[model samples]
Target: MGSLGQHGSKGEIELRWYQGSFYWSRYKLILMNVRFESKSDIRPETLLVELMNFTMKETNYKRLCSTKTVSAVNDNFLGPTILVHKWDTFFANIHDRGKYGITIHWHGIRQLRNPWSDGLEKIMKCPVPSNTSFTQEIIFFIEEGTLWWHAHSDWSCTTIHGAIIILPALRTTYSFPKHYAEETIVPAKCYKGDVMTIIDEALTTGGDPKISDACTINGQPENLYDCSNIWNYISSTS
Candidate 1:
């Protein structure tokens, strides 16, 4: 139910496969909150996402080439996109494997009567310490449409964030006309260095963090990063 293979009969299976292609982590239904509705005995989908250190390859811009060491979820800068239905409950088992602490926050998700997963970090919940894991229960009862999930601890959100797509509940139909396909485009600023270090240096010096170098669409800087391209590398497959 993400950017591709989101319709027809095999869409669901394809999406799950896409999740599998990202990181081979163990996941299963662990707990069930009775308040969450049971449609066809729906159970929680446990997602085990790991936070670790890695290096991203050359994102050459103009005459510059770079290989930046950074921290990410499942070795990806843009973390995993969570696909779920309205009124469905899922668990995010976040394991922090980095040097510092971290926590995840689901943006635009309505956690009514369940504030534990709100992910306020120091305000509501503490950060998941390094080498430890924390399980967050997410139940969306009323909210829908394209949302996001990001790191709630310190400056981690700059590198750890992903999409959250909430579809219509079971036996429910969209009030408006439905499209045959969908696309998820994230318009963001492209930075060439370690964002966590950028912020940490800024905090220590009381200076503003590094300004974004390029504006990107779907994580690509288009011709802004490379000089020998016309339309970047975005392709459409039918």
Candidate 2:
């Protein structure tokens, strides 16, 4: 449900110079134009796959959540090395008058046997209140092979889930065999009616919102969204 919405007032993006180089010794003026795109409400499952397949053409991958941006700086010091530790807070929602909270569970990363980093309620603490926040440091252990994240408390499967994969620093290149390229997927969905209306109409009517239809998928929408025109576009494209 979280996406970089249509750009207008809030505009949905910000740009700043992250790095600069001075080449007075070269005696010639040269400019390298590099642009990086960061996102908000990014799902970790998609992010990890992107990271695994990256060709090192870009220097970093950044994400913004709840007015804060987190960047996983890509270091080519020896090879492809990414340091995944260090963060002040993670952004997720809560409900039921602060009775429940959600934690972004990092499934693949090892917690070094630490409960707080384990992303488990029984192993750690309960979820916090909605709109509230917390600070924790989670270390990424690449040796675990496969990693995933999910919420530790209520409504976990509904809102909090993602996957994380760490690679060895020595590896230099990424390659995919013939059929492997088509094996990956990322899921996205659209609401039948305006998402805002679910809460808006409920407040206006003083009753719980009733949603009659919803659509879910395992990838981005390949065409524009319209009721009558939906299948026609797919048919034409095929």
Candidate 3:
């Protein structure tokens, strides 16, 4: 149900970057972009995320849980949660190990200096091709809270995403008391495909010509979401 890579965010860690590189032997992952493999409790480090055929069981509120296979980062059910300190700089190599190419967009963080790393497909750079890697320089200028990350490539992000938790820098404390316990929860929407199918049929019959083909899920096609936001929650731990 979960994958703990060599450089997971929790517990005692190993691996790190010297100058601006890493020891490739301890690496892992690739999604539409780089997955994270955190090391050292220090300010900066390079994380590895692999995107590949990831399979896991997801609970459906109305039915029994079923196992499904999809492209993922670091083989995690929900991509890994990236944990780092505020005002820190780290690197992540998004190695695409999936059937398709991808790009990673750090959802809301301000990349004032490293706009090139922004996963804006053609606007910034081409998608990281399958079986290749793209090194991203993540410089967090001003962000200190829970944010999200997802694939910026096509519909791939519909199944490849995760969360980013930025804590207070170094010896800094949060706004509230340290004694308060913290927890991270992922909220997902339960869907009914039948309704969308009705709408899709109406549009298809009335429209001059379908501008876009509807994506299929178990033989039924529907136009539900398009931002590829599905990737954001695909890699978080359950």
Candidate 4:
């Protein structure tokens, strides 16, 4: 007995076997598709009143201190940082609402044979202009784990980044024992001055620019620090 099976775009197979009784088999191919979209919201510059009163070591103040008395604050905000097994075919439709150009790079995604979705500006694609949108298809066959996405443009990445969690498929077992609960943590840095200004000053003066004034875990500074106490930490019950 013999049978033939054709899978869509992926591959095909032909099975042949001889037995006392005739036998036949059939197979079908199923494709998975997933899609996601992100918008870049660039908030206007503001001041951090708490950091305004704090001062660094007087010895290094000359190099690190800002000429202005207030701390500049401009953040690139995004919703829902963590993504689970949401889709099979991922389409990252990024809309740039910020003033500057931006692009997103899927940190751990193996582009596989799809280079168009790699999100490397100038190398693979161009930046998404302000007020415009760019859609990229992420096609990769790789292991499931923690991945990330971030702006590949300029200093925008400093604030425009998030975590990606790819869980095991349904009916699949973990390589290790499952835990009671899982939490994702992302640590980031914060600066008191405008990021663009800092870069410009460093490039033009050829000197060390001001360093970040604070550090944060998942975008929130420790409440124990000055001024940071205003930022509240809320736990999700769901």
Candidate 5:
């Protein structure tokens, strides 16, 4: 999640965001293999622009000989900054390997005259192990657009994948409407039966769940100001 800049031999990046009342610094993010569950069950509005995150492993070509633990920090998310260093890479599993070794593929990028930098089987090397690690360098010169990163070694592909969006250069500016609306995100789960599951569970407990029957905005518990899990309102249609 570092910035994208010319840092001589090393690549350092930064990103920033405007919170409320003041500007807040957004940190670069690194995520492990965690299940991304959709509680709300609704695909929120996806904006035309996007952001991306990249992870590193010990067995990567660059880190193979090192003995250190890596962790993400705030500095990685800073915008108008350097996002990654040249030659930065990650290891991913192939189609259906036993998770023994992993492969690294740089999507939407061409390794400047270096085919070795291209992460492909039979052409390059085997996959990197889990406990062990590998080193990969970011290859610049790739155009910016809707892109993604994924595993190319084994079944690990199902989990070890993330987005890769290159932002517009600072020199350029994009136009937008003046009456833009802010976005809101919620978390929840929905099955084939809808909210009825709550009622069923309540009935199974020998009591009325007290859920509403129509579209509800923000509900409260016993007290209107309780602001807890109280069922406020319900929606007639989904």
Candidate 6:
């Protein structure tokens, strides 16, 4: 997943996966920050900070795989947007800098024997308290392809989620013919009003929360809305 900024500046990290490989030859670390301007309105804004140790052209796969720190933050959101290679080892030092407590779950990484890194709050361990950090080691023993990470507490996953791509290693053959290009799609919904308020109301009344006002593809809403003209123009032109 990429970053969605205050002025609608967009940033994305792309990973290409070949069919049947067990290692990755390239990796990029991305950091993102999302913020909600008003408590009642809850307009979410995003910022992306990319930290790279090396650079290579599109056709190359060498030197792209390495362990790096990828962190995402919001006033109310915290997690990592990861790009994992099959059979590679991943380590993350997650820190909760916000006022509330939180935990993260790797959506599809099969933690068959090791449940400690499963990231279930109170199931495996307690939530990481504010201003505290925890180190997690994720091993992609057998799984491959696309995965995601998000907050496991309450309704926070709505805006705190991102994509993970696992690619094949160098000299590895694919199960199928490799495509010319690859893309990651994240479908999400955003509410116009405060999400927590809606959740609280639902919990109190035992009813459905307020429906989301907008749907997004890759964190961008449809071009029909008033605030979406810039994106529409960019989409049309690009």
lDDT of each: 0.60, 0.33, 0.53, 0.51, 0.34, 0.53
TM-score for candidate 2, residues paired by index? 0.36
TM-score of each model, in listed order: 0.68, 0.36, 0.55, 0.64, 0.35, 0.63
Off by over 4 Å in 5: 1-99, 174-238
Best candidate, TM-score-wise? 1
Runs off by more than 4 Å, candidate 6: 1-80, 229-238
Candidate number with the higher lDDT (1 or 6): 1
Clash statistics: count for each candidate: 0, 6, 18, 3, 54, 6
How far is 220's C-alpha from truth in model 6 (Å)? 2.1
Q: What ordering of candidates by TM-score runs from best to worst?
A: 1, 4, 6, 3, 2, 5
Give the per-residue lDDT of model 1 (tens digit) for 120-173.
798768988877777877876676788988788776676677788877766666
Give per-residue CA lDDT, model 2, range 1-238, as digits (tens): 1111223354322221223223221111111111112433222222121222111111221111111111111222112222232211122222222224444445555555445745566557665545465544354423423244445553323223334434322322223333432211223233334334455678889997765332322212334333333354345545
**Cα lDDT of model 3 by residue, 44-94, tens digit:** 322222222222112222211223345567655356777887655567777
Off by over 4 Å in 4: 1-79, 229-238
Root-mean-square deviation of Cα positions for candidate 6 versus the true structure, in angstroms: 19.3
Give the 10-residue window scoring lowest on summed lDDT in candidate 6. 54-63
Candidates arranged by lDDT, highest first: 1, 3, 6, 4, 5, 2
lDDT of 1: 0.60
Q: Which residue pairs collide, candidate 4?
A: 33-89, 34-89, 50-227
lDDT of 5 by residue, 105-209 (tens): 655766554455466645676655544545554444334543444455432332234445444333333345444432211121111122234556776898865
Q: Compare the candidates by lDDT and give the number of the best one.
A: 1
C-alpha root-mean-square deviation, candidate 3 = 12.4
